[model samples]
Target: MSLNSLRERLIERLTPAGAWTPDGLPDRSDYDLNPDAPRSPRTLRPAAVLVPVIARPEGASVLLTRRSDTLASHTGQIAFPGGRLDPGETAVQAALREAREEVALDPASVEVLGVGDGYETVTGFLVTPVIGWLAEPPVVSPSPDEVAEVFEAPWDFLMDPANHRRDFLEPESGPRRWFWAMPWRERYIWGATASILRALHARLYGDEARPGAAVGEDAA
Candidate 1:
């Protein structure tokens, strides 16, 4: 689909975001965040991330970030620029703000499309994926304290079911965890980030393609 078409479709699927919706691309009912399944999830902390799709002439690409290794959580992992919602802030507000802070992504330069379903993470975060379209690539500088690197993944590659892989990991704290993993070149994308992307893929392609993997969260 063209960039404009994609934008319009997203707005139709996810406008008036933040609230859980069963009518759109990101259907969340399939995900079961097992509370008694272990880990340290006490509550679902509200978080948001900007899924930036850059409109290139050839096609589109999704912007991704590698978190700084020094950070306490999810260090050195690939992720969309986003974080916990500040008080009184909506998901869109937090997504835009976090994007700006982490990658110098100008909110004025982006066209907000809509948001996907809210994903419940094992780390106690309820993350809303905000979709935004960039007509062209923007000047991006990673924050020294937050982002270690910035890159893009081809939209076509990401939305292909052939690349998606289901993997199992036995965490020390619980039973074997069956999660998705999408490896791109030297980078490994897995866990909650992959799950969220898979959800979006399922919504957009209707089971035709699946999210192969993603960069975010930890194995534990």
Candidate 2:
């Protein structure tokens, strides 16, 4: 799809930027896959992530990053550029700020399209996925303290339902943990990052495009 069409579709389908509430629970969440899991915390810390879609001649690509291995949590995981919202900051502001801090993504270069469904993470964060359109590919410099590497995953590969993998792990305690996974080349994309991508796919296409869990064995 062309950038114009994609932007129009996103604006039409995504939640309006004005509709996002700091604590309002969106229809989508991590619990979507783990329906039988325990309830989420009553007070969810609000966080925002930028879903940067860069315009490429072949097609659009999504910008992603590998978190620094030195981080206290989720180290080396493939993720979008984002973090907890600062005091009085809106989702858009927070997303842009986090992107700038993590990958040197210029806020001025991104045209904020709209926001997707709010995702409540298993770790007690209410994440708002802010979609941004980049007219051209960006020159991103990853911060050594926070990001190990910055890369682009083809938008087509990410949006294709066939590439969405149902993966899970049986924890020592509690029920098995299930989450979305999309393995690209040498990177393993899963957890909240993959879940957000899956949610976006469902929104753009339809729930009919969502696949059933792979049976008999782990698919991660």
Best by lDDT: 2
Return the top candidate by TM-score.
2
Instruction: Give the Cα error of residue 119 in candidate 1, in Å.
Output: 0.3
Q: How close is every model to the real structure, measured as TM-score?
A: 0.83, 0.90
RMSD from true fold, candidate 2 = 5.7
lDDT per residue (tens digit) for residues 1-220 in model 2: 3566667767888888877778677667778889999894578899999999987766778999999999999999999999999999999999999999999999999988889878888888989999998988899999999999999988768887788999998999999988899999999999999989988877876743333221101111
**Residue range 119-179, candidate 1, lDDT tens digits:** 7766667788988889889899999999999998877667666767877777787566676
Measure candidate 1: CA RMSD. 6.4
Q: Candidate 1 regions off by >4 Å?
A: 18-36, 39-42, 207-220
Going through the candidates in order, what is the number of backbone clashes in each?
4, 0
- In candidate 1, residue 210 scores what lDDT? 27
For model 2, where is the 10-residue window of minimal lDDT? 211-220
